[model samples]
Target: MRRNHTRTPLIEAIERHRSIHPISFHVPGHKNGLLVGDHPFYQGDLTELSGLDDLHDSHEAIREAEKLLGDVYGSLESHFLVNGSTVGNIAAILASCETGNIVFVQRNCHKSVLNGIRLAKAVPVFIETEWDDAGTALGIRLDAVKEAMKAFPQVKACVLTYPTYYGYTYNLKEIIDECHKHEVICIIDEAHGAHFTLGSPFPESAMEYGADMVVHSAHKMLPAMTMGSYLHIGSKRVDAHKVKEYLTMLQSSSPSYPIMASLDYARSYVGTFIKEDLDQTLEGIRELINGIERIHPQLIVQQADDPLKLIMRLEGRTGYALQELLESVGVYPELADPNQVLLILPLVKKGLSFPYTEAIGRINKALENEPMVEVIPMEGISTSRRTTPFSTLALSLEEMDGKVEALISLDDAEGEVSAGMVTPYPPGIPLLVPGERITADVIRRLNEYIVNKANIQGHHRLADHCVYVYR
Candidate 1:
């Protein structure tokens, strides 16, 4: 049975504390925004005071807030995450698996997953999820999980990113069921799927799929601020006590109270209005997209794309070119790379008018101004992605030593052990990760991104400096 979604203990606690208007000699030097002088934060800025409750301990308002969060997400327990889903991933992986256990991981997992594995000192058996087996699009097929499990029965746990950066999800309940059949713990990074539970029309949340544990970035799809994430435990098999301990270890000793309050308010707001608002909003966006398709036949909408995320494949231009054109026309996108542009939407599009008509008009105007440029998808690629056997750079606890060297150029990158991760910003998915031998195809992909001027972040400076290689 679903519990009450109305109570917002954390927000209420903050409001009460702020309402009392108590003078401060607390740890925060801001003194409830007084120091900042006229800044917006002064109202909600607070510390762990009487009735406010500590996040690490979570006895009063924090506990109650988590309960309300659990009720909204259908979790056995929920912990407010101030450190983003990164800490949630770290703590969840550490808490669930014993050190030295082999974990089945999705190859397309965010960099944080690798960090979690390293922190836990867990061995990884990477599961492949390439698009059309061409190594561009990424998602795990159900059969892939079955095959990996049949191959590695000794694997103690499995972690996957559901609703990937592009907002793609598989039949997750079936996957969880399969994980249970193998007695493997299942952890889901539902960081982008926070809005799934707002209504039935959206994809089913992992919480409902009975994943042993799942993490959500409330800020991603919901109205909460960035880093307002939550870690939810679903199955009784998980050691909640251990999960709590790891959370304390990984999360900050003093968390931002305002972020926690936003989480509380966002949950209450979503639980109350998301379903009805979303239903109407989706209808309007659908109508707008239909019109957009009719007008711009060259811009193809992805088949597996989310309603909130508009992933477009341009006919003549690469994703970078399309992004440039869109920006020229004032249609700001969330993220764009070589082949695609992802546009995240604000909710209630149909119910309330968002500038879709204006945005589309601008896109058409920009397309008219741009010179034609033909680009092939994955062009000039010479190699394919190697399935992880995760590199010693990742698996071993030893610091990067004499074995780690820098290659100043991409020409010599291939076949060298990668000592660093190269990830696209905004989405934070890795194009190159530690421990894998850099392949020719990866080199080509990196060049394409560089040519397109997309931002790639990692230890190696691909644009100018050396590629970190583990010998």
Candidate 2:
């Protein structure tokens, strides 16, 4: 028999408990919003108590909710992640790999994936990612993974990021099949692809391709609170017990009740989404896009494989300047990179309305009020840097374990091994990874980012033109 798609076990449990209006004495110390005062949602903020299942143990409502989640995603076992996809990525790596094990990683993966590799004490062999004309890094080609498997036949696991940050997807099924053929456990960080299960037009999810494990940030594409994510164990190859243990160790003991409830709600939201809902949402998007195009003939709006993401750019203006102009009119985009600004449209349903007309008017006003400044050409910055099909760290983890660090001029540090990660925000791909050798090309890219004033994340002294290196 088919399970009821409309039921939300965890959320229902929370509401049942909230209706009682029981007295406080709980750990939260908020006293049921008595102290917070005037915050509407604070009264629902709860913790582990009778009738409310513990996140780690999960015997009642949470367990039932997770079962519903598994039913929706076709996973053998599914779990709610309260610490965002970062914890899911780490737990997946820990469950699949042991210390000193060889793991395949996509070079353009998020920093959290790299941190997971570091924590697992696994050696990473990074497969190069292909880039588009707009300088956005895309998924690794199947041939590249095959070549890596041929070279590193003893690889224990492979972690990949499906649907690039810009929402581009490639042949993920073949890549997962190749990993399975080599007896490598496949773990996917599908942070931006939680809605792929909606089917049609949207690219297929990694889980559908039989990935051993897949992590999804429900908050990214679904109607969930921030930090609410899901981790699915799809195959028997991985140790489910180990995944649970790591999650128990990594996640906060007192998880937020609201976030978990939202996870349950998000799952039901997707499961119950109908064709009418999709049609309405797409129509709203179409109107928004058409109105924005009317603002200027030169404006470029590029749609990706994922219909929800929109990329806007204009000639002679940097994405940063466009982002600023949009913000001036109270319209902020998801993020802005050197090449373009990304917009994340809401996934609405029937009877719901988005203020598309108001947004278009604000966008037009922003453009008319602030004239765009021509961006200076970044000469000598090589957008297409040649990278090997597969490469390893310049310095072994053991070798860099206790190495002394020294601050040196970035221009003079080309040959030195980096002691930190230097990543550009928005996309969050690291230009330099810890234990990787700094090259002249890396320095040039860093300089380009510095000149463009893109937000740089992680450790670095780019303002002083210095970086930490293993001395």
Candidate 3:
């Protein structure tokens, strides 16, 4: 079948170059697979050849391709990234703010942004999300941003995660306008919504609404090799020159040619066929939803604010338990929390249709005659008020002085502070951040999680079988 998308010029150029064998006089020792005899796609992997341009100092092919990407996204500049969205977050944070500057960030942001703040030595003003008790997930509200800005007017930048891991998206246009009114540069982590520009049935891409900068993990939702991502400078508010400097500093000297090629290929794929691919994927999803409704009748598939992500809740099983069952049946989920399992359906992939359907059928059959189990809400522990510099608290776990243990009683940890970010992994918002006081409410949830055998991390156990508290 003839593909609808235009072939990526750079990728096509490389393919055309590969068709006719060229002499080996370039940087990569592989020399068109001669050096690395068994390497895959080595013949196409050439380093800075006469015609092929350099990624960092692009002038010809790379420059042209990136320009096309910029044009496609309607950005001031777009740089193809081989280091994933983590690097883009770091680069964006570093470029936009200086040390001691305050950055208002969504509390549910990826650890990468937190690390970027730490690296930049910037003060973080966390904007807490409105937690949906029934959903057990966070939904971003514009009012929270307004409240945070009111409290921290000196915030230099506002970083938000658009379409959170569970596919919850805030109103971007309104938020962007609000940030601009305050002269705060808006940096959006569009890591999960890279294919949003291909158009609905997906939420709008951050770039569409005039964010100062947007970072996308192309590999996450598009058919690009893993770790492929892009950093888009949207408005004149962003200093593109500084962003380039930061990108150069964070990026590796020797870039992956194959990964870059895949990125270029993916851009072309989205440019040409993303609409059709998305339509087909949505149809498949509709079919899956209908099948589940017909078969299980009682299973609740949590509807996402964004359409691409599929989240479901099983009547009798925890998300972890369901995840195990899915794996046993040769199906894998993108993320699973206590109450839900998430599936990321990439428009570019075709392998998930049958297996996903079959897996749902199996789950339905297993629950056929079983009575629906009521999901019990466990009370979480709260912490006492204590203010400490993050620098003083983030001392190495080994230096903190105790063996890791779980199931600590709430009564014993009265005056102690926590040494870890204790939260559910899939959602990953810390319930008790490092150095926070541990209260009975916090202990209650930890104990319940332990009793229920939920996966836990980052704490030590004492000889008394209680969780060892950090001093």
lDDT of 2: 0.88
lDDT of 2 by residue, 1-471 (tens): 548979998889888987987888987888778898937677768899889899999999999999999988899999999999999999999988989999999988988899999999999999988877666666788998888888888899999999888898989999999888888899999999989988886789988999999999999999999999999999999899999999999999999998999999999998888899999888988998998986865578988889988999875676787898899899999988766799998889899888999999999998764454565654422365566788889998899988998989888998899998999986788989999988887888787778888889877888898999998
**Candidate 3 minimal-lDDT segment of 10 residues:** 380-389
The parts of candidate 1 lying over 4 Å away from their true place are 132-138, 303-305, 349-353, 371-402, 406-408
- Name the top lDDT candidate: 2
lDDT by residue (tens digit), candidate 3, 248-276:
88998778878888888878767766445
What lDDT score goes with residue 33 in model 3? 88
TM-score of 1: 0.91
**Tens digit of lDDT per residue, candidate 1, span 239-353?**
9999999989878888888889899987886776645677677776776677567555567775344567777767777777778878886888888877778878767523466
lDDT of each: 0.78, 0.88, 0.72
Q: What alpha-carbon RMSD in Å does predicted model 2 have with respect to the real structure?
A: 1.8
Identify the leading candidate in terms of TM-score: 2
Stretches of model 3 off by over 4 angstroms after superposition: 1-5, 22-43, 348-371, 377-471
lDDT of 3 at 449: 57
